[model samples]
Structure formats: C-alpha cells, structure tokens
Target: MSVSSVSVDLYSEKQLQQLVEEISLRFFDKPFRHRAFFNRRLRTTGGRYHLQSHDIDFNPKVLEKHGMEELIGVVKHELCHYHLHLEKRGYQHKDRDFKELLKQTGGSRYVQPLTERKVSYHYYQCQDCGGMIRRQRRVNVSRYVCGSCRGRLVQVTKND
Candidate 1:
C-alpha cells in the first residue's frame, strides 16, 4: 500500500505501532504485543528488535527515503526477529530459522545501506605539489610531509 493513498503521517510513532500490529497479524497470524516507535538514532539499520523489552525501533529515514512499502518491509523484518525470539526459536540473522521465517514473511534479508556513512575526513594539501590527502586519523602537519614531494602539508578542510 502506498502512503499517497493515506492522508495521515505514516511515520509517527503511534502510526508505526499500529502498522506493526497489523502487519504482524496479517502475515504472521500473530499479534505484536510490544511497543513500536521511530528511532532517529538508527543510522545504518532500518529497524531493531530489542530482546529484553520486546520493543521494535524503526529508522524514520526508511519512510522518508523509501516510502511506506519499504517501511513495511522493515517492520516485517523486525517482526521476524520478535516472534522467533518470543517462541524460543533461532532468531539471530545467520540462523536457519531466521532465514526461513524472513523468507516466508517476505521480509528484506538486509536493509539497504544508508546513502551516506557518518564519517568525517581530515583533508590536507601538499605545499609543493598541491596534492591532497584525506585521512580518517588527524595528521600532525609538523611531523608528516607529502609522500610525493616531501613538501610541508597544511590542513585543508574537514569533510563530513
């Protein structure tokens, strides 16, 4: 189902909870008894299922970037984990039960990687050759020199 046909904001925490419950019933023939909510802090993953609390957390970006269909897919993926865990079955991603249930429920095997990683690079420029370098670790300009020309290096910019 497309969000375009629905007037309400589908990514709201309450709406997510209702959607999860509905999907759980429809696909798994089981009720989702735990809470479901959007978690802005989820960066690389589309959703998370907490074993201790039986709660599900979804990444809002799934709805924003891929729309309701993808969000529903993620919900189904988490539900696979949720139900399997509650039933004392194999719930880990690498387990046979997880793979089988995920396939049976039409859940995504893996969430698409985020378009961008949350990484920052320190950039430097060679004074002599004008060559540039990018590194995850900050370089000491006084100690490190350009490899090509052995020229002094200067900080350029920090890129996100």
Candidate 2:
C-alpha cells in the first residue's frame, strides 16, 4: 500500500478516553471527567483542550506518524491545560505556571508535522545585516523594512 493511503487505528474512542483519564491522574493528580476522542479535523496541533466543554480532542496523526511515546507526551501536554484550567490556575501557554507544570510533567512543547503541505515562499535579503527572510506570501518590500538593523529589503529569486 502507498504511504499516503496507510492508516493507523491504534485505539478506540472509549480507549482514548480511558488513556486520557489515566494520564491525567498519574501526571496531574486529578481526574479527567470530560470526554477525550480522536479528531480527524486537527491539522497542525497534536491535541486541543476545549475551554467551553472541557473536552480534549486528539489528532490521530500523532499516533499514526510518531507512535505511542509521542502520543503520551501530547496527552500530558493536553492534561496540563485541562487540569490547570479546571483549577483556575495559569492554563494558557504564555503563563509561568503552565510552563512549569509542563516541564514537570515532561510534556511535549511542540509536535512534529502531521502532513506536508507545499508552500511557495518569497525570499528577501537585508541590505545592512545581509540576513535572509523567507515569507509564504509576497511581502511589501517598499512598506516593510528589516526587523533587525532597520535595513532596506530586496527580493531574491529562488526556485524551490
């Protein structure tokens, strides 16, 4: 079978919920009362913790591509958000408490790319610092200047 058509059905929805509950109790010393299930719609993020319903949705691609270890790390990360938010602590990523708890729990800070999407970039060079900048969309060189050294930017031709 082609790699693109390959699929992984490692766990059922009920099993996913059980796993989340187990991880939450083990790592956070709390219970996961809400639902946890696979979300096929998730694209870039490994998992998402909802604020309204208190549910956690996981991207199956994490297990499919990276395996169980990475999936556990992602579960820990989501549990960090779930528990902290429920306790009315700093649950957001920018908060210090979230960072500390994430560190303590050994949660993943970033997930590997789930799928490859081809994006064409416009390359630019700074005249002063000689630094290169890559942008997915065409940048307005006339209006925008280099973030560092405040230098004029010139577009560079690159065939990707």
TM-score for each of the candidates: 0.70, 0.72
Clashes of each: 0, 0
Error of 1 at 23 (Å): 0.3
Give lDDT for model 1. 0.86
RMSD of 1: 4.0
Instruction: Tell me model 2's lDDT, rounded to 2 decimals.
Output: 0.89
Top model number, lDDT: 2
| Model 1: how far residue 58 lies from native, Å | 0.7
Best by TM-score: 2
Against the correct fold, how does model 2 do in TM-score? 0.72
Question: What is the per-residue lDDT of model 1 for residues 1-160, given as tens digits with 9 covering 90 to 100?
Answer: 3323543354566767778888999899999998999888999899999999999999988888777777878988999999999999999998999999999988997777766767788999999999999998999999999999999999997555
Candidate 2, pairs of clashing residues: none
Q: RMSD to the native, candidate 2?
A: 7.1
